[model samples]
Target: MPPAEKTAWDLARAATHANLPLLGTPMSQVVDRLLSARIRQNAFKVRPATRAGVMVSGGGYQGKTETVCEIAAVFEDSWRELHGSHPETVPGSRDLWAPVAYVQTPVTAKPKSTCKAILDFYGAPTKGMDLPELIRQVAASLNDHGTKVLVLDDITRLRMHRADDQDTLDLIRAFMSMHVTLVLVGVDIPGSGLLREGRGRGGKSVNGWEPTQTERRFDLVELDRFRYDTDEQITAWTTHLAGIENALRLLDARPGMLTEGRMPEYLFARTNGVVGLLERLIEDGSTEAIVTGTERLTEPLLDSLPLTLADSVGRDVAAGEVPALPAASRQPGTRPGRRRNTSFDDRGSAASTA
Candidate 1:
């Protein structure tokens, strides 16, 4: 039904579907396992050694930041549970206990700017403070607030060519020296010059330049796109689609609307197996389905919806051509045939020839 025809209740349900919570995937599971283990181990250690950190790196729309943030939030929830929800405050001090501090690396990030971002998270003042003072304040705040995990998102913005950016990177490395677990989220971190050692005076190479201490202490993990080349990969991809299908609320949407027949292949072609792009496609398709009275996701309906510029350019580069979806296999009951050729028939033919 069109918007004009939709009852108020129908419109309300559509809105709910549009804002569904983040669906779990295999990639998220891996990240959750690794990050959660690191945070848990760091929590128990009483030693003064610098705690290790995690760096989540991936291409655009891979949900690196969301996944890490969600994990950090989970850790905070448990940490607060173990400790009391409210701690006692001194007569002159504020009663603030933040187990997790999340901040974005400024676009024009410097050492002072980075420190200010962390202090800002704690609502601490940084006015008229120099670099050293700001750094000291940041450490003090972390200690006072009992912060166990600090997430620095969009860390790739700090390119290493400039002196300020190099100092910003060093400042982040110093954060690792504290007891807190530092989580850095960025795009293409390996190529972002973050892992490399800084240059000496006049941009000259330092003697025996090697991987920075930050790189050594931080374990880099990638949130990769879904793959469909093998049986296991295909199963994982289809399982992910099923989770999305289960979450959708369209009246006419059937169980296998997204996972059945060529729909899976078509969605993969459209989204290149990126979860963010897949969610966008589904969200838009669901809205159109609700509006046009179709109430179901069909290939034609999805194709008619305009492609996001990123998805369009990425699909073009990856597939090289528009993939053709079989018209007959679009129905919910239909199943796509095996992608691999049958070896039994080939063997029979070879035996006959012999």
Candidate 2:
């Protein structure tokens, strides 16, 4: 492990690992949803599989949330690059309201959020303070920023009804009308995975949680874990797994860290190979270490895992029988989220919400 990662892990020992489904779960959905929306740009005029789309998957505790946050950092960096003329204190300072895309935080809307409040966060969404003049403001906002992108991260928590696809689609369109791209990240809708039934049907024809489609007018890009990821992505995952194994070895903690065959098998079984779940497993495994301080985790730790994580980690990500590989070094910014995010508690020990 790199000195930095080691340093992070050290800091994470006290009270770093936990499951904040409230926050992490929603955040995960948002990342995939927004990526799907971005992919839409690729399929303009009913184009092929060109609509922008990106997904991160793997078992518990592997770093999916970390990956998403890393992405946010990318947007933040891009925002900084475009406006070398912004404040030094602000993280991504171009008035914030004038963002290239709209990003919804995991804030609860019990109090209700307005279009005005939403636009304001973007810094300068062309529309300024006068939203009643929506058309005019939208036009100006688009002209100033080009197409906007929106991400309602884990939007399901807002007390909104899932039954109404039209309403959902319209609401999405209303936000999209701001000329920015829109991303609806939510928990991976299970079933078929991410299949699209057709237009108006919210693109949900089974096969998983499909984003709702409006008027058969838009595109689709749902993320899935079954697909192959880049070698770099794989490298990041193994590095995390290796770290967990190393941690277990160091502390000599319980049930026994995953053995050769069981490593990936457990990963697949536990987390469906979703990176978040992989991390979660590590987190739990580590916690067991912290608590018992002596017991070997082994397959016993596998028992406490959530279904999604279990299915993924146990079945998919576990590198059964074969020894896992060493991690390849990574460059800053070049590697997104899970790579740089020290977000997990035990050095961001877990992120199990696949």
Give one digit per residue, the lDDT tens place, for model 2 in 1-354: 797985676456634455322223333465546653453443232322212323332322444434455555466466556666433234443333434354443333321233443455445443334435644554455435433344444433323333343243344455544435454444432221222322322424453544543313344333334211466544444544555555443255433355343454445445544555455566766666556644455555546533333334222222121113212222323332233334653664577889
lDDT of 1: 0.78
Indicate which candidate wins on TM-score.
Answer: 1
Which residue window of length 10 is worst by lDDT in model 1?
317-326
Can you give the lDDT of residue 64 in candidate 2? 42
Q: Per-candidate TM vs. native?
A: 0.81, 0.48
lDDT of candidate 2? 0.42
Model 1 lDDT per residue over 214-255, tens place = 668898888887887778888999998898888888889888
Clash pairs, model 1 backbone: 1-293
Global fold similarity of model 1 (TM-score): 0.81
Count the clashes in each prediction: 1, 115
